[model samples]
Target: MLPFYSLLLIATWLVPKYCLVQLNEPFLYISATTFKFVLTSTLFLTKLKMKMSKFVCFITKKLQNLSIFVNPFWIQICYFISVSSVGFLVLKVLKPRNKSFRPNDFDVFFMSVSATTVSSMSTLEMEVFSDTQLTVLTILMVLGGEVFVSVLGLHWLNSKFKKQETQNKVIDPLVVSVEDLRYKSSIRYLSYVVWAYFLVIHIVGSTMISIYMSLVSSARNVLKNKGLHLVTFSMFTTVSTFTNCGFIPTNENMIVFSKHSGLLLILIPQILLGNTLYPPCLRFLIWVLWRLTKREELNYLLRMNFSDGIGYNHLLPFLHSCLLVVTVFGFIVIQFILFCCMEWNSEALKGLNCYQKLVAALFQSVNSRHTGESVVDLSIISPAILVLYVVMMYLPPYTTFLPRKNDEQSLRSNEKMKKRREKLVENLLFSQLSYLAIFIILICITEREKLREDPLNFTVLNIVIEVISAYGNVGFTTGYSCERQLKHDGYCKDAWYGFSGRWSNEGKLILILVMFFGRLKKFNMEGGKGWKLM
Candidate 1:
């Protein structure tokens, strides 16, 4: 009876969406179902709270006990699964606004996965989505993109409390070591600070984007419900930039905002700080400011070391700061210089003035590293530029190197640290390279017939770019067509001419796997036990 009721309630909530797609007389059925379930659930929950139903109370208690297994790993996995599932369900429920060119179930699921993974790949046109659908995509981005250190910290806290004995008051082995305790403490503090940090960054970035959008008369006219549209667009840009989830609301993406320097200004720093590099860069900034102020009290706070009053733990963060800054900036400068020298007169940059070209180069460099957004068309770029992008994306996140402990005991500890760092880098490289390799192999095998049929339409470079995009989770494509032959007959001309929409089901499945691995590998690399402080 309980199981039946629960399933009924769930179905009732979903009926409206399903009805819109399937049934002609949906409203009557949906409204009746909704009312019945709502009334029944209200009565049952109310009665259970008043101790009128022992069965309901038992079920509630069981759910409470089961929640103990909810850790960060499972939470992340669940988030991915939930987003995909909800997206699949939504697509199944909603009827297409246009009768002619309705997206199949798989197409919806693929786009959902792309959005949830932040891969920025899309088979269907984004410009056609209703406001409700965009809202759903935005929510998925927020959930999937942002790092949930807070949830991780809370789980740690729960584990700690659960381990305490009422009589013996024994400390668990997990938290017994000083280093372990310190790590846990750091996580707790980080979890607390991370939300506030995200809020501040988003507010600033969104404000700038909003201002830029308002200043542009054309943009204002195109986007109706000015205030709401600005906020929605700002949220999309903010999350997309900061989380490195590069799902642009508009089809044109950064190209539309090319003239808006104010928007680019916001995007540049957000991309730099939003990627894995942000933490170290932030620590460096704080340290520099503290040094200039020369405030001894603030030094302790900034260092994030409450127990060690000597400020000895600053070494790791300092080193991290230096390494990230030099590596990222160096790569960007080299790439920008190369772009100017090699592709100065390319079609992508032909319309742009010198300043705009410089900005475009900078944007591409930053975006290629992780964020995946692009102001210029990647398809038209020279091989040199494409190679640069591949290299940048292939390199692990700038913050991949784990700094050695400040106070090491012996040569063994130092050697252990070195080996751990090496292993981390190795894992990162292997993770990305393996994905790229598999994707390439699959493309060749699955797309062999198609390639032979239309050699001009499907080139090796097109496939390589797609694989790189998937493996890096960068989402930039050479606008490859989905079918072997150009079905549109050159009707829709965009830089993404040979984009994901044209890929076969088998090819898309392979890329989906690539995106999953690209995202999952990061979580696996970060979660493993190699980072334990000595």
Candidate 2:
């Protein structure tokens, strides 16, 4: 048992290091291979079997005792906070690209939280970050992404099931129910599917982006001029887009590459696959598996129940999944039409030709939903379009247009609805809007001077948009401009950052909490139901 435990710890440390290193690093490969060989050799030692069994039982009993406090919501919150803290420390130690620029401690911490939550809210320019800082951000975004987090959750569930099975085997094998077995099998299958989805999209997306940048001299030159490596830019953009984080390597975001319609086209699918279109895509994948393998577990996974037969919420019914696809596209089309009509002759699209404008409009429309990657200055866009973008950002990623069920189906679902309502605690008294209003008010107080002096730039509408964007975990903002200030002072200087970058320390702190709240908003989806106005 001692030998096995020691080897397990060593393996865990070596495996992660090995994975992070390049293939050209043969020393790590040899170390990993040697560790694996030694671990396997020790596993076959018959003398340790009895001790190992005893240790397993001891650990299982301890875990069972401690399981009462293991809430998934708290686990997720802690995960984000822990990752953010680590990122902050790493960024603090790493030197910035610009030797003269030294960001405030609060801003560095804010950037860490923003990246960890995939919110993309910035208080500093993107180019100021060294390549190491960018890599750290890339890692944070990938780890914080919805798809990657879901995969981690699936892995946790699978391990929990395995532990339960082990305990049942040791205590009473017959206690394991048929339903439990089916559920466990389904979780394992879903875990595999999610992992495949995450890996395949990243691999394909990065590869395509790399190839496009190579062929397109204009795109390649943008990175070269900025002193960015082609591979780093490709991987960073791919991760950011797929995660819907919107934190591009360049300060201007997608605006710098607005003319690269091909690049925008390449990213559109990646954005959808990672966010709004995920549920439908997952359902389709399971359906395809059901078709190929004709497996009962996959079929059970595709069930129309809200619980999805396996306790996974994302796997929607066939009808609901189809409706979600239509609803998402419908929103995109509406945004595209309005943006094109309003901004067609505006300065935002002035330099671009008609085709470029169309592609840029489509890209902006898609990003307005959650990605937050913009092709044009959002501040310069029409107020009407900005309002539309705000609404789009406020809506949840899985917002779908589900048709009313027939009488019989409605009757059948009533019991489930009642059960769900019964689980909602009265303590969750505030709605999502209520929280947003409170944040907006706090921000206004913090930025009260700015609001008064620069009414045009710091209008209530702009404040509302910024607050909603933070609460929605979308990074869209009516960015600050010294030009828009009513009375321009010598102190007023424009910085290449988001609107929130111009916010005071107190306001920035408030938005940091908003980003955290938004990231964990799934846990409180039914919150504020107890305080319904109706």
Candidate 3:
């Protein structure tokens, strides 16, 4: 502990000098003040070291006791809430690009929640947001991304394991299990792999995007006309795509650059790596590590059975990993064929050559799964294609094809009796679909007036799509059109916002809850499984 304080004192002294060189004068002044305070406190504490150590130990024990009653699930919920709240305040204080376009408090708060949850459901147009606000949204997306959150969880679990191991060594010097050691090491290694994956993808994606924008005249001109910098657009697009948040700096999302097939192709891998294809990519990385390192922990990660292995869910068995890749691309292929066939000559895909159309179709197919960047206006697309998109959005990111094996059946049979006993006390509550149904009903109730007044634009299918998109955390929407209104009133005006933008405040709040539910959906993967339809 004395050594810890010594290191802290050294850091306090060095950090202010570093900040003075790198940061602005204000930050340097703040750091200097902090350094002085810490220095004074350290000198005083050294004089009263014996008494201060006892006080620190007492506080640490009290904190440990308090942490025992804190649930991890609640901690996650609190994290989102706190981030969203801070984002909301920041957005509220920051000025938008448009001087007259001040977003309402609720809309700002809604955007914060959407960004924090990576929902990307927006009520305001993207162009109104300043570059600073866009940067904030990018930060929220990165912090709220699945990979980032999982890595944080892994780090926390690793620390907990180390703490427990230290206690075990104190209790009995030779009592540590080899399996526990391997599991802990595997977690730490996995954390490193994920961190590398996150950084490498962002760096590569941003670099490629920047180069493409610089080399391509059309894309560069589009950013220029919108008053966006090359680096800002590249970084924002990469972060948004890799997080699968679907937030584009432009109002049209990916539509304006649809003809830039090369740009579309570049973003496709980023979309996949961040969401649906994450599991297969992760398993492949682990497999490669095992092949190269021949380490026991890598082998444990690669060979462990999903059901009884290390608690990490992304590390799938080899067979399942292969199946996941097949299933993911199989669905994409189906959607691609259907999209090209049906939309080749449609107005939705007008003005594109055969090559561009093909690339755009494939891009849209990949995005429909979870990444919701769209090249075509989905409203103009064939209803059949939209229905297929809905189905794709409803499926979870890791949905895969797995054939039941005889060995797995035998293993399940061994647990059948225990499952049956557990089922006796299991509560039959709302399933995932049940919850979605409730959200849909609530939104319908809240938007009933508009549903009747603008049935054409506010169709039940559009409502379902919006709700499902929010629940899936995919930002796809059919979009609202003033011309499509049943009766064109004088107040009708077209805006580049999602379908949910037309909904009342209550409906937006309901969608907010849906986004929260969707973000934390892994906890409910087994929901409604306790009920037997037969």
Candidate 4:
């Protein structure tokens, strides 16, 4: 660790200096931070891809030979931890030189882990970081989230694609089996299109945001003479937004762009599409469209042979997609109705017109689903709404979002499948509630003294919101920036909303553990759900 840390320090110190000089030249192609982000993202992605490939091969060969079983839940857990550890170390090595305020080592590590987990909790203000460090953080967000895992799935999918291609060349042209067709369709629709889809969205989204920023002098000036193109802001915003990692270029977050409807339009779609169940949803959507259009070429490409009856296996992805859609839809509707019924005239939504209020409701509802970007200060919301948020975050529906095909060919009974699904849901809910209890308890015990000293700021409600945010990995806060509090020898007089920036080291450690556990549990439980669905 010593040698590795030394090498990282040397690189971090030297690389920026060299790149700064190069970037000063008029003809240079890219900024240093962007270059670092690209280089690091590529490196991590390649390593992860190779590891996944080797693991898959090992499972197919060695594990099968030994007649031993290894659960995907454990495999996913290991993958998450390994990638996150590397990501944290990289952030530590590439620590920012631009001192907004000097951050302790734990702050950087916490941010790195949060980004890797795709949980966007911030322990420090984001605006203080150097561009190079911020770019690294953005890359970590993308790589740490669904994008990296999806790419690994694509690596396995490549072999599946080749196998299907070979099968397509068969002279008999027998009807494709349900499983074969599902794989082929998923590969064609998801594997092939997902990257292109993201690229197109990024280009369009960044353009929209940059254009909006240009119209605002405050945002435009931030990019001025910084060797950052107008598009750079867009790129960073696009990636972070789509990954649902709640990082913002500014410390104030989306509050600065609260009135910007164009930005909202771009963000909402990205958040919706980035939901954990999107891949499976996409597969089902394409399948439906092919059926509606009766496009022979599409059907041929997807290798869809519908001669056999559509089995429950074929419908699982579609069912999962439908459930996700309903879940999000139901949540938004319910939240909006409550907002109207309860806090219609509250300061949070007071000045806004009816239309703006509705839009605000929609945004907050979507955001509550762990998207983390906030347009409104959460502190002012009624206790009822806050309670609703706690519930939404603690038990996000994405925990059971992706379903895989079952291997119960021997006992093809609908009754058995129904029972299995019920059991799976029971286990998921139980685990989530249990974890939530543990997090809340730990936070309470750790912050007892702090709560006593500053009851107003560290009230029970504030503690609950903060704990849920940490456990849910959502970064929404009432504004308790604790960096100042922790720095001073005495308690700070400021009423900055949100959790402790000034918390004891022990308190911060509890939040860190909760955040990590939340992220790790998400992947493990979600993957386990998919396995059970199969």
What lDDT does candidate 4 reach at residue 34? 37
lDDT per residue (tens digit) for residues 1-534 in model 3: 677767777777666666666665655645464444445344533544445335434443443444579755666787788789999999999999997889999999999999988888999999989999998888788778888777666766666677788898899977887877888898888887887787778767877787677667789899999998765687789888999999999999999999999999999999999988888898888778878988777777877877674657776677777887899999999999999889999998899998999999999999998878999998999989999998998888878766745443235434743776544433454588999999999999999999989899989999999999998999999889988877988888888889988889999999999999988887665566667787
Q: Which candidate number would show the highest lDDT if scored against the true structure?
A: 3
Q: Which candidate, 1 or 4, has the higher TM-score?
A: 1
Query: Each model's TM-score?
Result: 0.70, 0.84, 0.84, 0.69
> Model 1 over residues 419-530: C-alpha lDDT tens digits?
8665575444433455577689888788898677667667787788787777667788777543436444556344332266777888888888787777666444433333
Candidate 2: worst-modelled 10 consecutive residues by lDDT:
40-49
Tell me the spans in candidate 4 whose CA falls farther than 4 Å from its real position: 1-70, 95-97, 157-189, 216-229, 276-281, 288-316, 349-355, 399-430, 481-500, 522-534
Show the lowest summed lDDT stretch of 10 residues, model 4: 306-315
Better of 1 and 3 by TM-score: 3
Give candidate 1 misplaced runs (Cα > 4 Å). Answer: 1-78, 91-101, 149-186, 222-228, 284-316, 399-432, 481-498, 523-534
The worst-scoring run of ten residues by lDDT in candidate 3 lies at 44-53
Query: For candidate 1, what is the lDDT?
Result: 0.63
Q: How do the residues 16-113 of candidate 4 rate in per-residue lDDT, one tens digit apiece? A: 56655755542122233334444333343455445645765543343233323555446556666665677667666664646445677777777777
Position 133, candidate 4: lDDT: 74
Runs off by more than 4 Å, candidate 2: 1-67, 404-424, 532-534
Model 2 clash pairs?
A: none
